[model samples]
Target: MIENQIGKRFAEALSDSITDDDRVEEARDNLRQFCNAMEQDSQLGRFFLHPSIPEENKAALVMEFCEKISALEEVRNLMRMLVERQKMCFVKNVSAYFDEVVARRLNQARVQVVSAQPLSEDHIKKLKTMLDRVLGKSALLETRVDESLLGGLKLSVGSLVADASIKNALALLKQSIEKEEVLSEFASG
Candidate 1:
């Protein structure tokens, strides 16, 4: 497992170095995209994390990669530090935590919603507005369809899940009926 402190410190360093919101967001995007690439391509991750490759070569490769991605100086420095410490395998974890830091700075939450069917654009917009107001933060919604949902929506934001699906409602009703029947039986006996 990657150490959370390492990612936290790297994100803090990057956050401290950039003051402009646009530039900060750009840096975050650059890191996020590159880390996503690393995650999606195992060969890329292996190449970077391989012990046979010398640290200097790794540094050069990382610099070139960062330049290609137009990463800011702070991001480049963090990548170099990761290379030096031989922590390339933890790039995804670092990027994820870094994104959290950026999102927190922007007062936003990334929400995922699953429904029985695809929602209309207007419905999506209304849901976003409601979530934004209810969360007290800007909501970035990602939607998906699940046929098993029956109807309604399931929203996940951070650790909270709000399930309003007919499936869930039926399950609750069944449980309530079972509990009431048990209570009546106990009283009668």
Candidate 2:
């Protein structure tokens, strides 16, 4: 929880610093690349999290990385600030929250749709339109096939999930029947 708060604060600050939409996206990409590098290289990750290491050395390495990636100046400064504050361990969290911030800023909602079979292009378009209308924001749909659903679709938008699948309906029906059986037994007893 604390990590999310810290990351959200940093992400909002970074997001506010950029005025151009393109730069915001570029910074996001740069941050993602930097975070990926840190995660993939254990030695580099250790170096950043080492408390005994001097901040200057870490800041210098950060600058080198930013230059290599051609990161925006704002992004570079943010990285330097993280190093100075010894908050480099939260880079991944910050990156994740940054994406959410960007999506919110762009008035876009990412929706994950799972269905029993592949949807046609027309069906996808209709679904996207309906989502946009209902959500009051543009919908970015990521669709996939989940045959276990049997039929119907399951949609996930952020923390909310809407399950209209045959499997889910059957499970609910089963639960209802079991509850009714227990109630009938109590009445008879």
Best by lDDT: 2
lDDT of 1 by residue, 45-130 (tens): 88997899889998998899888988888889889998998877777767878788888998989999999999999999999999
Give me the displacement of residue 75 in model 2, in angstroms.
Answer: 1.0
Off by over 4 Å in 1: none
lDDT of 2 at 164: 99
Measured by TM-score, the strongest candidate is: 1
Measured by C-alpha RMSD in angstroms, how accurate is candidate 1?
1.9
Q: Model 2 over residues 21-115: C-alpha lDDT tens digits? A: 88998998999999889878999999999888999999999999999999999999999999988999999889999989989898989899999
Record all residue pairs in model 2 with backbone atoms less than 3 Å apart, i.e. clashing: none
Which residue pairs show backbone clashes in model 1? none
Local distance difference test, candidate 1:
0.88
Give RMSD to native, each candidate: 1.9, 2.8
Alpha carbon deviation, residue 182, candidate 1 (Å):
2.0
